[model samples]
Target: MMAAVATAALLSGCSVGVPDPAAPSNPPISSGPGTPTITPGHDAGAVAARDMPFSAGATLAHGVPVGLSEDLAKAPQWKQVVSNAGGASRYQKSDGCQVAAEVRQNQWPLVAADDRASTAALFAYLDPTVLPAYLKPASLRWGGERGKPGPAVDVLVLERAAKPTGQKAGRATVVLARVFGTAGSSVYVSASCPTAAALAAARADIAQWLTVVPPG
Candidate 1:
């Protein structure tokens, strides 16, 4: 159920992972010819990490599961540079933008079972701690789609900094989502963008490119 919502949000190109009937809609931006693509240089360390195979009983990192999806592995324009036996993988582009995702079996009981509940739980966890550490106060907005049996929650965070005199301002955006499954399994996905425009252009495709498979 959570996966379905994430998939829909990605396919629909919605800014938020889930649709909000009351939220104002915006037109999609056009990516004309010569649009700069994110292409980050490869890291040898990351390449060595990808040599590890995904295995069962792996632990989650930053709420993401451990394992590479065929969809993501085969996705064009991205390369998996870091992977470990624990199921964590990092994808990078030439532009320094990157994404990481993973899957793991939950060790705790299902406290937040659906989207609404899971969103609440996630907000509580991220609001006082995670968001503040990364974003300016009141910079995060919450509201997307409701979760199903295993609800999926999505959040987007953006931070801006004034660049040195004469240089363009710097901006960064991070997109995160967690999808729950039966038997206490969950998949976490996240991406880091150097600019808001890059985040907007790539978030949906990157999210959609991931395919989560829970361990048996």
Candidate 2:
């Protein structure tokens, strides 16, 4: 019924669609034939480096959902460059730091299901192996919060990528993404940071900013 999750910015308009997690080019580790009963916690061996916060909030609440609320792009570090309607947007800073939401669906079945497999699928969608060398974490982890999860799935993933062309490529380009679902809606959110400090701050803000509409 519950377990720990192991964990996109999209552009709005200009014909940008919700970046489908299934669209990645690499082959993924299949969820397998049957659902594996994975306890809602992380094993030190399978999940090395369990240093992040345990549970994000007091208890699970449904209905309310999360989104890219902060105008991080408004600040000088990240200036807004593109804006469109229908749940897609992008913002970038001078040093190639940026935040974006590639998918924001108010009601999506994939996320609302909240199955461990679904969560795993979403978390593995970006597959960190393909990230540029020297940018990926020396160690990776996927377990956080040990509890039974609801149909509303909430997943998070941390990764790194090369800065946009012509910017600083070797700098720490951290990518943080969240798959949030509650009540009856779901969203895929992501942000890229130029430094570990920036990613840390951004993760806190994003985790705190999520919302879910409680059912009546």
User: How many angstroms is residue 175 displaced in model 1 relative to the true structure, after the best TM-score fit?
Assistant: 2.8
Q: By summed lDDT, which 10 consecutive residues of candidate 2 come out lowest?
A: 1-10
Q: Model 2 shows how many backbone clashes? A: 26
Over the stretch 1-216, how does candidate 2's per-residue lDDT look in tens digits? 010111123322222222445546464778769534233442323222222221321122343333343344445455656563465556665655555544444332344344323333444443434322322221112223223222222344445533456875533333333333332233344555656667666555444332222211
* Residue range 145-181, candidate 1, lDDT tens digits: 2121221223333233223446764434443544332
- Model 1 off-target regions past 4 Å? 1-70, 107-112, 126-171, 179-181, 214-216
Model 1, residue 97: displacement in angstroms?
0.9
Candidate 2 segments whose C-alpha is farther than 4 A from its true place: 1-66, 106-117, 125-155, 161-171, 180-182, 193-216
| Per-model TM values vs. the true structure | 0.46, 0.42
Q: Report how far residue 54 has shifted in candidate 1, in Å.
A: 26
Which candidate achieves the best TM-score against the true structure?
1
